[model samples]
Target: MGLIVASGLCLALWVVLWCFHIAARDAAMISFSLFLVAAAVRTVGEQVRQSNSREG
Candidate 1:
């Protein structure tokens, strides 16, 4: 949830920067967005593993 929220904020900032002609900042926002996505994926994977272990 936190990761998703952060990604959403990053997406907003990216758009804002693009609109204002701030090309350099876009790189940072893009990286942050990617990081958030990776973190979210890892979090989901951990939850799945925990659930599977409990069921097994």
Candidate 2:
């Protein structure tokens, strides 16, 4: 969904900043990464559940 895309973009931005040595503080980046990971996990879980329901 849009959230997944947004999180992915944020992560990409974080990586780019890191490579350029202009990233924010470690805590902020890590927090963003964690939130993105959580969103991804939830999205995947929802997809799987939907697929299983359809199959049933």
Candidate 3:
């Protein structure tokens, strides 16, 4: 589930960047790395929220 959402977000970002031709090779690599980290954070955050909700 998390993988699906994360991949979708990554794909969307790449698509948008390519469409606008704004991201170069180097920028794309950096952007993808940043997006990956952000997605991981998002996944962790969602799990934390769910755990707290269940505990409460």
lDDT of each: 0.93, 0.91, 0.93
State residue 52's C-alpha deviation in candidate 3, in Å. Answer: 0.5
TM-score of each: 0.60, 0.57, 0.54
Q: Which candidate model has the greater TM-score, 1 or 3?
A: 1
lDDT of 3 at 46: 100
Deviation in Å, model 1, residue 38 alpha carbon:
0.5
Lowest-scoring 10 consecutive residues by lDDT in candidate 2?
19-28
Q: Which residue pairs collide, candidate 3?
A: none
- For model 3, the stretches where C-alpha displacement exceeds 4 angstroms are 1-23
Q: What is the lDDT of candidate 3?
A: 0.93
Error of 3 at 14 (Å): 26
Name the weakest run of 10 consecutive residues (lDDT summed) in model 3: 17-26
How many collisions per candidate?
Answer: 0, 0, 0
Reference-based TM-score, model 3 = 0.54
Tell me each candidate's RMSD, in Å, in order.
17.6, 18.5, 19.2
lDDT of 1 by residue, 1-54 (tens): 999999999999999978777666787899999999999999999999999999
Error in Å for residue 16 of model 3: 26
